[model samples]
Target: MTSNPTSSPDPIPNIATASEAFHTGDELRERWRALMGPLGFSERLLWFAFVDTTGHILPALNQLPLDGPPEPYLADLLMYRLSDVIDGHDVVSVAMLITRPGADAITPWDRGWARLFTTAADLAGVAIEPIFRANAVDLVQVSDPRADGRSVA
Candidate 1:
């Protein structure tokens, strides 16, 4: 029996360059879909909402849940893989919800999340400033139209 190379599988494309080639939100979303391949609605929603006007990072923050648990480091790793898409640019905004004074105090969970975000930012070599808020409602004022676009309401 002859081995068939064509019937095997195609090599995965390099994500760095693939992400750099994205020129719009839709392009980024498509590339993300290609990379993630069968993700959940939350994951898809996160990627779609985070791509910026130029199809880059800042927009991604808008997709994360302000009050939910931290996503695994893999998600951050994937974001870092797209570093070329926002290298040397001011991209990524980390926002935290604070309900009261001194509510921004760091906890074990916060430390873990910080490590993920910081590590991803370092690997990506981009700016990811943290924004602390007094409440979840504060984020509503800065809502993304693209995020709203996905809303059925």
Candidate 2:
């Protein structure tokens, strides 16, 4: 389940430096877009980027295996573990991205994952920015829908 339709090399998008701020959903979505880059993948991956209290991005961008919906218990455990890392920080939040092979549209499955993640973060008392999804066609913000009843990319 993949597509490499382009004969030319795929362009690598620029990554945000540690100094860059991701204060808004738009900024976070841009980061996800850069990380995703003309999306085409054989499997799904969950990516995370931490933001400090001042909105500056942490140095690391994490990637984890994702075969299906996240286990509730595991999600809790993961968030709790990460909480320790930012415990002493002045302020911190999380940004998530799900990249898989598919069309641009957000599916019910994607919404389900977003709900699970939001719930887990709520339980852990962790703040999370909007979540984004990158598919074979486009990258979009999945957590919050626009006022016009549309998803933004």
Candidate 3:
């Protein structure tokens, strides 16, 4: 902790000290959503991932609809998990279509998503410009990425 004029301090690693910001942010968003409740965000949105020739992954906005929610949905819920599925190939872009909240409310919930996508691009060592159209609240109150069989009571 040298503040001497002749010495400099080490730069804080990661974006905006966001090394742990993603998870902290996710928790914050979850709590915010819970606090706002009915006055906040919608329940569902669209999610799409694109894969390049090499099988690299990038999520994108796809109008094409699948038969239903992703399999093993854990009670019809969409897992916002992408870290494990977006590498080793040629991913181009990812799109998450969020539903507009009834009001003009924009929370920091976007931070986590930003972190995930940014990390992917960083690892891939490419510059990516993301286009955002819309997004919905990721969930009501479940914080665990793999928490299964939830009961809304």
Candidate 4:
């Protein structure tokens, strides 16, 4: 039988055992580096925070899945898990501030949290400044300060 050049089978490599998988720190860094390539800056920062704080974010992420919507409790749990790393003293406060307010307006909380997260990411050397600036522009445009009973009108 002739093997077609375009029909190569997928290569399966040896997988790490459960105990080996849970080995944190440098091991986790290696896994993350392999999983998320060089351009995955945000993920790398989060992984660093996870490794620094509790040596693992995989357990929390594992509780979720690759498919479907994450449970509400999972979001809460994630926020709690990231609290220290994000330096967010009040997760509920932060959450409440960012939720949608109406059809066309970006809430103050959204801006606040963006600023906070962006600041934290900058301090962590995550190079998220451009993302933050883009979002800030979007928020300003969506809210339309002049239309929000502001003196700018």
Candidate 5:
């Protein structure tokens, strides 16, 4: 019997467990790094993980398609889903990651998505932490002006 080389094991060895605390931006980035593995995706994806005011992460972490649907519709979808988990006690915040297959540099496109989400979260009255971006080279905390609380168009 010959073993198949094509069938490789998953690269991500460990993932964040429920209720794990992420108190700061650095900690959140580390968790994103763990979740993202070596940073490479064939298509664009937006990853979401719920966190509480005390920094404890909720059990739900999901990846959604980045394309299709208008931005407002997508934002509405996200807000609707988030409302189910939020109780204003245990689950009060969210963290996001935008990933794609490309160079590590942050792009305008990335900023646009971040801005849109930031605006949506604001309107929905949800607390949002700093968003992050990942590509073929690196995972980084998004530092765009929009993400920093500037108006989103």
Candidate 6:
């Protein structure tokens, strides 16, 4: 008998677990609250991967998949890859967030960041956004000034 080269085994190593599945906003909100806990700017404020969609990749207290690749482990690599995609013409589905020092706030987009975000979104073909509220502000993107049909910031 010939074994199939492209077959997933029972214990598929790369398959997403139930917990690894995409999280809804509500579910993520609960998780975020739990993560935030009672620490008032005491714990590290960072943006772990939320729903990285063409819509919005929220950077806040959100339900992290109990089993997804941790942010730090993939941040640098993800950024480099994203840059390459923006600079190159490869499979351009991109979404990500950055960690910063704050209290349940996202790293606001500056002029430099706006350029990066705008470029990435344009190259990404479809669309991608980083969503988060800062210091009780309503949800906002990285605050880009350009209207590239992508960076709604």
How high is the CA lDDT of each candidate model? 0.36, 0.68, 0.33, 0.28, 0.71, 0.34
Clashing pairs in 3: 56-89, 56-90, 59-94, 59-95, 60-94, 60-95, 98-134, 98-135, 98-136, 99-135
Q: Which ten residues in a row have the lowest lDDT in candidate 2?
A: 144-153
Write one digit per residue (lDDT tens) for candidate 3, span 1-153.
212346553223333221121222333233233322333234433334443433233323343232333233321222234434444355433323233343323334433443444444445443333312232312322132322232111
lDDT of 6 by residue, 1-153 (tens): 111346432121231221232334333333333333332332222344333333232333222221222344333443544454442233223333232334343443323443544454455443444333222221223445464243321
Model 1 per-residue lDDT tens digits across residues 52-71? 43434332323444245556
Candidate 2 per-residue lDDT, tens place, 30-109, comes to 66666666677778877887877777667678987778775677678767876776563654777788888876478877
lDDT of 3: 0.33
Could you tell me which 10 consecutive residues in candidate 3 have the lowest summed lDDT? 15-24
**Native-referenced Cα lDDT, model 4:** 0.28
**Model 3 spans with C-alpha error above 4 angstroms:** 1-41, 49-91, 124-153
> Model 5 lDDT vs. the true structure?
0.71
Candidate 4, residues 1-153, lDDT tens digits: the string is 112356552222223321134232234333333333222111101122222222233322121221222234433444555454443221111111121222233445444444444444334433211111111111122232222331110
Query: Any runs in candidate 1 off by more than 4 Å, and if so which?
Result: 1-61, 65-72, 87-105, 131-153
Per-residue accuracy of model 5 over 38-115 as CA lDDT, tens digit each: 667888888888877678666667988887433777876787677677777777778888888786488877877887
What is the overall TM-score of model 6 with all chains considered together?
Answer: 0.32
Give the best candidate by lDDT.
5
lDDT winner between 2 and 5, please give it.
5
| Candidate ranking (lDDT, best to worst) | 5, 2, 1, 6, 3, 4
RMSD of each: 16.3, 5.3, 15.5, 16.2, 8.0, 16.0
In Å, residue 101's CA in model 6 sits off its true spot by 1.8
